[model samples]
Target: MIKNIIFDFGDVFINLDKQATYKELAKLGVTEVSEEMMQVYYRYEMGLITTKEFIDFYHKKFNIAKKDLINAWNAILLNFPLHRLEFLKELEKSSKYRLFLLSNTNELHISWIQNDWGNNLYQEFKNCFEQFYLSHEINLRKPNENIYEFVLGENNLLASETIFIDDTKENTDIAKNMGIHVWNINPETEDVVNLLNRKEFL
Candidate 1:
């Protein structure tokens, strides 16, 4: 039986445009995504670099201002539907499973979320989870074998009894390979509110 549920924050709970950042960056003359930029991005996501260092790299390389860079960086985040929170709350209240949130997220995006949702609302969402793991804070990221191992080892969770839900197939695939169950949700048509109804959970 599945006794643990690990959820991805983006798309699984909060809505995301995914490409909005690219489009926004294009408007600021960032037409091409360079390898160095990608490396910097990955490093930023892993918390290997400071936020100021991240913004400064872009500001220095692309000649983009800090504020504009921040704006473009945060453009991907969208609204959180109330219904998803309700579903999560109901699931948490059941006490049937230990809940967790694992996301490959950076500081700017989280700051934007906190500002947009307000601390109280953000806490309301966070409080539903037994553990909240942010990639930057944790210095680990998804699709990485070590990350999966960390989550499993840290909580003493049995991979066989854990279910990880994510919108990205790559992320889910890694967990699935580790003997955990997964739902690579299609946000375009699938809603997390129908989780228990999914065949994996059933």
Candidate 2:
């Protein structure tokens, strides 16, 4: 019996273009995403680097303006539709499972979401979850075993009774290794609402 549900925010609920930001940056002459650039992004997601520092690192390295870089970085966050919001709200009404949100997100991304969705929409989204965990905010990220452990320990949730849903195979695999049930959903093909209705889960 799955008594808890952990959802990945980016594609599971809110839409994100994983390659859009990189494509935009490439247009600005950042033709390749180097390992060092990836490390910078990881550090930023871990909350070890400030937003200004992140922007400055790229700006100084690429000689791009702050605003232009910020726009490029934030291009991945597109929009949140009411249907998804309503689906979550309905899911919450069931009260059969404790819901949590876990996302590998950084400060700039979150700021963009807040601004784009506005406070009311954001609040409605938050209201659907028992706990909302962002990588930068918590200093932990998915695909890392420790993050799943942290959530389980912090919430006193049983691994066997929890279902973790994420778009990334790596994250889902990690959770499965820890005895948590997982749904490695493909947003392009699978519908989450239908997954929830499957007889196995219910």
Candidate 3:
């Protein structure tokens, strides 16, 4: 029986245009993704660099304005459907399983979400989870075994009793390898509000 539920934030709860950031950056002359750029991004995601440093790297490398760069960086984020929150709240109220949120998110994206959703709505969503782990905040990221281990160990959760839901196969694959049940949901066709009704849980 699955007694713990772990969810990915993007696409699972909040809609995202994953290509929007790259598209917006291309407009600012960031036409190519260099290895260094990816390294910097990985570091930023792990909280190894400050937001200022992240912005500054692009500002200097692409000669893009701070405001424009910030806008491009945040373009990947879209809307958070309220229905998902309602479903999550219902799950939380049931108290049948411990809930968690684990996402590979950076500070700027999180700050933008807080600002866009307003404090009340953001807090309401957050309150549904027993532990909310953001990559930057925790210095760990998905598709990494240690992160999965950390979540399980810290919470004293059994992998066999946990179900991890994510929109990315790369992430879910790692968790699945560790013996956790997974739902590699396709956001284009599936909605998290229908979670329990899915075949895995049914």
Candidate 4:
């Protein structure tokens, strides 16, 4: 029996356009995304670089203003439906399964979410989880063995009793390797609420 559930925020809870940032940058005349930029993004997600530094690096490299670059970087964030929020809230009411949120996100993305959703919505969304873990905030990220270990150890959760749901195959693969059950959801064809409902979780 799954006693704990971990969800990935980006696509599982809130919608995100996986390629929106890159597409937006291309529209802004950043015709090429360099290998260095990819490294920077990785470092940023790992919490190894500051938000200001990340923005500055992109701004200088792309010759774009900081504000515009910020917009491009945040373009991946999309709307969070009220239905999803309500679903999670309902799930939380059960108290049978411990709930956690784990996302590979950075400062700019978080700031954009706050600005877009406002404090109340953001708080309500966050309140649905027992623990909310952001990659940048925690200095660790998914698809990394240590990060998964960190969550399990920190929360005293049993891997066998936990189910991790993520849109990324890599993330789910890593969690499965650690003995955690996983749902590798495909956003294009699946609705998280529906999936859970099918599992009789709702």
Compare the candidates by lDDT and give the number of the best one.
3
Off by over 4 Å in 2: none
lDDT of 4 at 95: 81
Badly placed stretches (over 4 Å) of model 4 are: 198-202
Question: Residue 80's C-alpha lDDT in candidate 4?
Answer: 90
lDDT of each: 0.94, 0.90, 0.95, 0.88
Quote the positional error of residue 137 for candidate 1 in Å. Answer: 0.7
Tens-digit lDDT string for candidate 3 (12-123): 9999999999999999888999999999999999999999999999888878999999999999999999999999999999999899999999999999999999999999
Model 2 lDDT, residue 13, Cα: 80
Is 2 or 4 the stronger prediction by lDDT? 2
| Superior by lDDT: candidate 1 or candidate 3 | 3
Candidate 1 clashes between residue pairs 3 or more apart in a chain or in different chains:
none
How do the predictions measure up, each by TM-score?
A: 0.98, 0.97, 0.99, 0.95
Q: Report the candidate with higher lDDT, 2 versus 3.
A: 3
TM-score of 2: 0.97
Model 1's C-alpha root-mean-square deviation from the true structure amounts to 0.7
Ten residues in a row with the worst lDDT in model 2?
191-200
Candidate 2 has an lDDT of 0.90
> How many pairs of residues collide in each model?
0, 0, 0, 0
- Mind giving the per-residue lDDT tens digits that candidate 4 earns over 1-202? 7899999998887888979888988888987878887899989998899988998887787788888888888889898978988888888997878999999988888988999999999999999898999999899988989999999999999999898999999999999999998899998889788756645244
Over the stretch 47-159, how does candidate 2's per-residue lDDT look in tens digits? 99999999999999999989999999999987676787877888899898999999999999999999988899899899899999999999988889999999999999999
